[model samples]
Target: LRLVNMRFECVGAIDLLEFNICNNVEILNCDFAPADNDVVSAISTVNSSWLTIRNCRFSSPATDNGFDYCLYAAGGSNKNLHCALIENNIFDGMDGDGTAIHIEALCTASQTVIRNNLIMIRGAGIGIDDDSDQAMVIENKIFHNGGTPLDVNASLSLMNMLSDDGTVTWSPTIAGLSA
Candidate 1:
């Protein structure tokens, strides 16, 4: 499946795009901005493989009941993602405790690349939350978020820039930038 050059707005109470048990999916040059506070995620993938999401924009209105995420991907033991690429995207103007990007339970053999993205959230929100060593997080500029910039369990994070206030501080052991 391929979705290109599309605009999704105000899709209420659900994910704008969802992929479950699907493969070889591509989403490019898209815009996702939901005014509804009940909206879950701009994109959600579960047990998908070979997926690519690039050149996209995601934003949501401020809500006390924070939405889940701008992008969410999860894989389990039986059905794990073989590969995924999320790059060149922009996420901004979000509020509350929701995450910009959330990934979890990826297969050890699988490779997930998240790079070259811009993430800025208004309130106490995380920039990225990845819980897989198979993920490579690189070169993303994350700023103005009230929570952790890159909360990753991955072993391959490189060249990423993060700033909550005017100052930026990160533990090299946490980000895996050092031995």
Candidate 2:
């Protein structure tokens, strides 16, 4: 399914788009806003692959004090998922404890890419709980957040990057802390 240039508003803690066992789904140029929800999210995908969420906007309550997530994607323990991408999106007015993007531990995302995103938040930024070996988080601008910017729970899962020519090498950091 493809959701493009659409608007979705939620009055409660319900996901705007939730899917499972599906593939090749794309959500682009969409607007998702939730009103006064202490717990909710805009997108939630489970056990799916080839999912792309790009050029989208998300807005949540500014007074929420509980768990409120913007996007939640999981693949479970088995990790059969193929690929997922979140890029060129904007997140704003998030006011809660949860992260803007939460990648669950069970998800073994083979090729998960989160890049070129602007995250302006009043809460946490992003969280990756799984060992996404092929995960690439590059060039994301996260600021004005009340909580940490990034969190990777799978300590050993964080990989070192080396250029194809093997000249450049770098490692990921968790909330500005060396990994």
Candidate 3:
């Protein structure tokens, strides 16, 4: 773990760090907030490999939230093991009212790079279920979500450039872009 700066509060069910089975691991510039632990999986790597999380910031747990995943991985599916590189992280205010990043159900992440992150919701910013494949959710800026910003049921074809508007969305029929 190459965590820099640093700030973590009310943590539980933790995976602020986990490089299971293990390989090249590095989580940099860290900050985790308000965690309570809601386990199903939290950074698993029964047979891990090259993992990297940069500029980290996973939040929300002090009193009203729990983690399903702030980062996760699991048993290798069969072939070229788990290869990860999560970049520029800032998954804010996770409360399990919104799950946060989970890539498991049998791993195979190649050139994985979830870029420019800021998942703002309660339950999902990333999730790749069973038999995972080439992963890369680019330029992330996910939005207002009590849920469902993303929930990949996992096949070899999940793609996201998700931008849920970042917050000024309520068009009851025109007159707001900053009228």
> TM-scores, in order shown?
0.84, 0.74, 0.26
Pairs that collide, model 2: 76-106
Candidate 3 Cα errors over 4 Å, as ranges: 1-41, 46-69, 74-107, 110-141, 144-161, 164-179
**Is 2 or 3 the stronger prediction by TM-score?**
2
Worst 10 contiguous positions by lDDT, candidate 3: 168-177
User: In candidate 1, which residue pairs clash?
Assistant: none
What tens digits encode model 3's per-residue C-alpha lDDT throughout 1-179?
Answer: 35567665544554544544666767678776554544333344555567776887766544256455666566444532356677777776555453556655456666666566666665433322223545655545566544566544233223344444444432121344342
Instruction: Give the number of colliding residue pairs in candidate 3.
Output: 9
lDDT of each: 0.74, 0.63, 0.54
Q: For candidate 3, give the lDDT of residue 94.
A: 54
Ranking by TM-score: 1, 2, 3
For this target, which candidate reaches the highest lDDT against the unseen true structure? 1
- The local distance difference test score of model 1 is 0.74
> Per-residue CA lDDT of candidate 1, range 47-110, in tens?
7778888999886555553356888777576655557888999987455777888877554325
